[model samples]
Target: MTLQIDGLTKRFGGQAVVDGLSIDIAEAEFFAIVGASGCGKSTLLRLIAGLETADAGSIRLHGEPVSGPGLHVPPEGRGFGVVFQSYALWPHLDVRGNVAFPIETAGASRNDAARAADRHLATVALQPFATRRPAELSGGQRQRVALARCLAQGARTILMDEPLANLDPHLRGAMERELLAFHAASGATTLYITHDQREAMAVADRMAVMSAGRFLQVGTPQEIYERPASEEIARFIGQGVVLPVEIAQGTALIAGQRVFLRVLNGAETGPRSAMLRPSDITATDPGAEGAVAGRTLSVLYRGGLWEALVAVEGLAEPLPVHLNRPARAGEAIGLRLTGGWLLPEAAMAAKAPRRAAASAP
Candidate 1:
């Protein structure tokens, strides 16, 4: 029950949008592909769903070829479900009608399709809105309707293309929980695509970070956050300050402080970047040895903590420091880095790698 994509490529106007990508998604695994907008995440999903033809490569499900050079499986014939960002419900259809459409399309009788729709509606807690039209429902309810319609189809693999993007912040949070519960109950292999790193972190069992039509790294959310493969990945995945450093013997001098490395990108080292998350840095006494001192530029209250911008020497940008207590602007403070990741030069290459690294970030 694995989905294997080999040499999957797509292009438009002679420019490659998805370039020679390969990945294996395991059965019932919640895998997410995350990147900035226009990184081709949605395009890849469209290619898999057969909405767009691939210029090259093949896609296999459970060892059966569905897409390749010549063979083409229509979206419905592939026995998969897709939930898009727009909710894509028929304007004239009520909730039950929308949910039953897929089942009915698969050759089920009207009564049987209605029954299956009822079951799926209950799974997503949308049974209460069974008679409401798409226009009559709230954004969250509309999203649930779309999801319920997909579930009613009973596809083993579910592809969601930023389905939560249309919801407000609070509704998005609620939907994320419902989505996870549905995935657990359905036992379906889910491929979620999003530009929101927080959404990817929340929903994925594993995630891939993409840029410029290629995956930079793939790993569990925690693994990617804790030990990013490169400075670019670290910056993309979360809030962090990538600082230049000098390394030797599993140690590095970052911001003038020598700290132990939890992970190193490779053996070769001279000048490299260290990922120092705001959580990894702490305020210290002024003039402390091996500590970097800087003037406070700004202090922002982030609900639970205050994030201060500190100006450090030998750095082109201001360093971000998360503080337990608020500090005044124009004040001075020293910073001590608890620990950090040592990114090798290759991981920092300007171009995508020719081969996937054997590490996760």
Candidate 2:
């Protein structure tokens, strides 16, 4: 299944929810849409699912136009299945019955539906609990059953809307892997939505970071991480800090000196903000190349990392540097700021309205 959104706009009372959103989703690829709540991420999914209407613009499923008042395709007719955050399984139905429901609705024989249900349940590793009702299943088990049912429904495309939201941290991680495995095995064109940066980065083949209703940036995980288009994109992706650093030509003005750093964008000279990733900052000897000395103000363990708050000269406040090597608090150390880019703040702010839209039901 492939999806194409061309100027797809959804509005409520004259406010655009999806704005002029255009995206092309390829068949057998996992595409993730990420955004904060109230940013219309879920509404976009609903629009694609035919659960809601777009006030303007177009949505194409395999290149067929979709929208308008009476000309509508319900969820079932869209050839898609959804795995919601709540699982949405019938409490009174057993696992087998729940998984077989869609097939039964399509007029499959009793034995055939049961056989298909059992097969799909096995795919999700939940066949052992076929007779168990949703009330008797664990959270992760119920989620797997939901996935089983989605697969059994013969959906060409799967829309997973934050399906891992209700799981615990450990379960979230486990389920993330399971979803990837399931997607890999099924080779279904999957579109997933999430607010979790790490989750989007970890699983998606490619993802679009959104804010207000607009896509901040769309690229591979590495492209979005190593070279973000703006400060907001950098911050949303959760990397090093973006500081207000002045730029001159190809060099940045810091510590009262023009220091050279990498520039992904060819902008030279003028006021700008440079993005510094946590892992990019390093502790080095005084004579080491590009070293900037600073006094450590604080130190904290970050998993396998050691983060320290250090005061570098020529900066108003202390700059937070992430060091892999352990450092003592209050220790005088030489710091180096390397591997970041100076970006225009205004460029990112301009993308907001083009992204946000009206509310969805």
Candidate 3:
């Protein structure tokens, strides 16, 4: 399914929960929607699922117009398999009964539905738990059941809303691999939504970063992380600093220091902002190129990556250096800014209920 959303908006009592929003998902693409809570990620999903009415805008599936009262397709008719954060399974139904439910609803005969359910159970490695109800299954087991049910729906497009939220850290990783395997074999267009960056980076073919109620940026995971479209995006992707800068001839002034830039593209101006990610800064000795002397405030060993807070109060902003090698806290150090890219405020979209940006932080 090539899903397209254009200018979708929903308002209640003059408050727009989901403001103007649009996205294009390619066929067989594993697209991801990420943002913070209340950025309307789930609401956008519901609109796609036909669970709520859009106050304005249009949704098209495979280029077919869908929206408005009479024209909207119901969830059951959409050929979508959805697995939610809670794994919404029937407590009364055993695993086989649960997986067969969707097939049964579509007019499959009892024997046919049971066979289909069995096949899907095998696919998700849940055949042994065929007789287990929701309560009898673990979190990951129940999630597999939900996914199996979705597959049995004869669905060509899959939508998941925080499907990994309930799983423990180890289980989350396991499910991610399973999802990719499923997508590779089935080639269904998937739209996975979540607020976790690690999850998004792991599973997404491309990440759409949202803020407020609007999409701030959309690109490959590398593009979103490495060459972010704006300062806000850079901040969201890496631990960094966005400081006010004085732009003059071929150089920008940070604090009282003249820092040169390798400008890629931007507007000419007096005052602008420069974004520097922590990873771009490295500890170097005095007299090294681009080195600035400073005192170390603190050090942290984060997931085997060392980080130092270098205090250069003259720079107005405390710079964070992400060490490529480990170092101790309170150790005097000199650091150099590799200097990140430049972005203008105008380049940033107005903060709408960004379903993607909600996951920015």
Candidate 4:
């Protein structure tokens, strides 16, 4: 492992923001930590970068202790590169100068540093903008410069904190590609933090879903999406609906129809929650096997496909479905569940108190 954290915890005013977190990140692997705002992801990054002192935990990088009890290394001494959301370029220096500055600080001669900077800038395809100052470059270009500076520093580990948050949607897509290219070229261990689950899915080899100072689950994007560990994670990672259901003998009883259930998390015969994604349910012929009658509660055209919510008898919430054509409100429809995951019994039990509290009044 290139980075290993154990028992990591940080607090503010008696509230734990990062509570007993542990993860092993392999060298040159891209790992993403995704969660909503105030989930302690950024603070976790700062701890790894040595910008914030961990109240309790051990941070080991390639067998060296950077952070632990009675030991702390400053950010500069860690030799890791950090990219912030704002890009953090020096206004006074041109692109080439900005990239060269780190090398010069590491004891390279001025002329030697400039030559090395040009080589690094070429890696990011920004050699042509070497003379442009930070103010003269677009947001994307400035971001490349930051990356080039990281290359010039020869950093083997890079930490990025929502680096694309400042860009527009279009640029964000472009930068996502650019970031993958940069990672391939650098081969550095990357720990990326983002609130955007889609972006994390796009760039990460693996991702962790965090909430309220703890990691709820961590796995490949597909694994997390298709087989979420809990109801909270199922709703957070992607579009889906969790409806109450009864399970028996590897099948689920939903809306007066029996459908094969993809049992996950060792859910047994009992009342549980079924997680159905838009793709899991499809329009089928009326009275087909495992088909359930429903009504279109609402529909919206999403470019190429129509997204609709369907209310089925005996189901509490509407299940989301996709259609090839327009759907009308209150129109009768037939839907079949081709596949769905069952939430574990423990997760269903854990949710009972909250559900009870909300219905108490």
Per-candidate TM equals: 0.91, 0.87, 0.86, 0.92
**Which candidate order results from sorting by lDDT in descending order?**
4, 1, 2, 3
Residue 287 of model 1 has an lDDT of 82
Off by over 4 Å in 3: 248-269, 285-290, 324-329, 345-361
Of the candidates shown, which would achieve the greatest lDDT relative to the real structure? 4
Computed on alpha carbons, the lDDT of every model, listed in order, comes to 0.84, 0.79, 0.77, 0.87
Name the candidate, 2 or 3, with the larger TM-score value. 2
- Candidate 1 lDDT over residue span 73-192, tens digit each: 888788788998998999898999999998898899999999999999998888889989999999988988888887888788999999998889988888899899888878888999
- Reference-based TM-score, model 4: 0.92
Candidate 1, lDDT over the whole model: 0.84
Better structure of 1 and 4 per lDDT: 4
Best by TM-score: 4
- How many residue pairs in model 1 have overlapping backbones? 0
Residue 321 lDDT (model 1): 90
Candidate RMSDs in order: 2.8, 4.4, 4.1, 6.2
Worst 10 residues of 4 by lDDT: 352-361
lDDT of 3 by residue, 131-191 (tens): 8889988888888888888789878789999999978997988889988877776677888
